[model samples]
Target: MATLESFLKDAAQGDLVPWSSQVLAAQRFDLSLATVEGTILYLDLLPARYQRNRNMISIKQQRRLFNSHAVVIGCGGLGGYVLEQLARLGVGRITAVDPDTFEEHNLNRQLLSSPRLLGHAKVEVAASRITDINPAVTVVPVLAAFGEDNGVEIVAGADVVVDAVDNVPARFALANICGAAGIPLVHGAIAGWYGHVATQYPGDTTLQKIYSRFKNGKGVESELGNPSFTPGVAASFQVAEACKVLIEEGDALRHRKLHLNLLDMEVVDVPF
Candidate 1:
């Protein structure tokens, strides 16, 4: 087995680019006549060996994710982390929707915003950051509210949907869209030291059921009440589960919910 490091050292002796058939075949370690011809013509376009290894893992799995589309309904605390992770993992296309603009307070956890981005649209900031992270990723930014009017179209084109939005109405709307689309929706919510995440698919655990416990009470109003670390931890888990669902890898949190208590440093996975 040729190691990626050695192959990169050898390839570095020449020019290389990505996505060319030659680079694709060579990265796959296939030296057939077809691959040979492609390589001969575009050998200078091959991706560096490290990138090849990082990007091309089990051609079947890579193709599955590369052909999939994901929609993230919030580009705030959780959505920012989810978008960044998904882009890095090589998800083919991403649609980011958010109606808010970056503010000074967001600098605490929002990865896409900086001092310069204050007052700029969240989707624009996230789209630019996503492009910088992975130019190959196709990012669509929609600066609109995810409601009944746009929910169907927003969820229709996605293979998977992520609910990182802050409010209940938006989360419920996205969940409904995912259910209607028959796609899996990875859901996450944060408040103070507590946070929760779940994977809900049509005909499976719905966000309505998971959030039933809080319907009777008035939810937290001030975003300021949410501590900095809460969204980070919850968003990380949400992104992980979303990737698992996208890749069809290990078991996901479908039909189950995960609760985290940062104050006590505890986690519990409960069957829904």
Candidate 2:
């Protein structure tokens, strides 16, 4: 019986494995495509989809991403973009958590929302989109809100979590759960032409310090009424931070916030 790793190593073309070879290997071994892709990474062969990620992401980091599990706590504005980037960037497993169905209002800033998808559940749509983008990535669409009832179980084994929920209380709930679970949380928020990205590690009180004044409100997004570009900008930063955590590389946004004013095309560092 030929082993999966041996097959992938033999099928590689100078440190890169084409997608066709990956597909053939999966079929030959009776394995899921994701399993085959993981084996390719384990053997230090870059998948064709991630060929461009080379020189920035090394073979070791790509393998780490293939084996990583990430949880995105909201599938609305920020989360939709976060999920999109994570899958494209080759995170192997993702858990998308969002309970709401898309509505007309979401069309303004939500990446996965469309006139055709109105009233469709966000997580399901997200899962389908992720699959369409990267079949090697497994998406677990949880059609439930992130709260005490399911937060711990939802984030179990995650290398990192992204905060894309709309409300301040929900953000705190997610932060608390991640703190208890020893998982890092990449926090992102958007308000009109503004957005911010920060990272919170377990035992850190950064999120508490940031949202303490908001109380029960969902932040200034209600007043600002986010523009279409804000979530994309914020999610870009969030995804980069999340990737840093997963790869255990780079200067992650821990204890500091990267604030953006797209209205003026300016970036400001807000340190905590």
Candidate 3:
């Protein structure tokens, strides 16, 4: 394997190349694509992989994202898209927890679910997808339920936790775990044309306060099955929130929820 410094010198181009090209160069050098990317970044040269992310986030923030660890519980609707975006954004490592398999019903919105992947474990599919999206991203797929017993351990050492679970009870459990761990949790839920996104930090009771009425009951998603767009939109919001927290930029949805109604084309930021 060639050293990263020499590889960068050999592959130096006057113009930026796409991520796929970077991957090919890394393969030729028998090096991880991330190593090439980091070397290029160290030289203050922008790889085409994250060129678009430059205007929104500084190079330092981009480096921060590459060094952050994010945990996503429940790899289904919202989880699928959240993982997709995080991988593209160059989040260094991700722990994806999902105990379910893809069903025929998941074809509607689950980004990683397809007829070919039906019945496959969600976490397994997530692993494959991120590998293709960005070889630099390390995805640890857990084939277990995130319950009270393992909730704390699941999110331990994480820089951020994402609540992509479908039920209110699981959300509460994850929220409590994150609060106790002092980790920020980005929450997103979709029910038909309506969805919500929130950023909850340690010592914040926003989650408990929001779900106080139905802590033990199923979420509205149970009654109103998700549409294709709802989960996609909500997951995008969740990824954006997580990125902001990781980069420590932008005002988070902290202690507040961004409600979306696609049918009416309106967004309301509700504060607790």
What lDDT does the true structure give each of the candidates? 0.75, 0.90, 0.86
* Highest lDDT model number: 2
Put down candidate 2 lDDT per residue, 178-223, tens digits, no spaces. 9999999999988888888899999898888888787465667788
- Lowest summed lDDT window (length 10), candidate 1: 41-50
How high a TM-score does candidate 2 get? 0.96
Between prediction 1 and prediction 3, the one with superior TM-score is: 3
TM-scores for all predictions: 0.79, 0.96, 0.92
Error of 1 at 70 (Å): 0.5
lDDT of 3: 0.86
lDDT for residue 191 in candidate 2, whole number 0-100: 89
* Residue 143, model 3, lDDT: 95
RMSD of 2: 1.4
Instruction: Compare candidates 2 and 3 on lDDT and give the better one.
Output: 2
Better of 2 and 3 by TM-score: 2
What lDDT tens digits, residue by residue, belong to model 1 across residues 127-157? Answer: 9998887665678999998997889988887
List, in order, the clash count of every candidate structure: 2, 0, 0
Model 1: CA > 4 A from native: 1-57, 213-218, 221-224
Cα error, residue 233 of model 1, in Å, equals: 1.7
Q: Given candidate 2, what's the lDDT at residue 84? A: 97
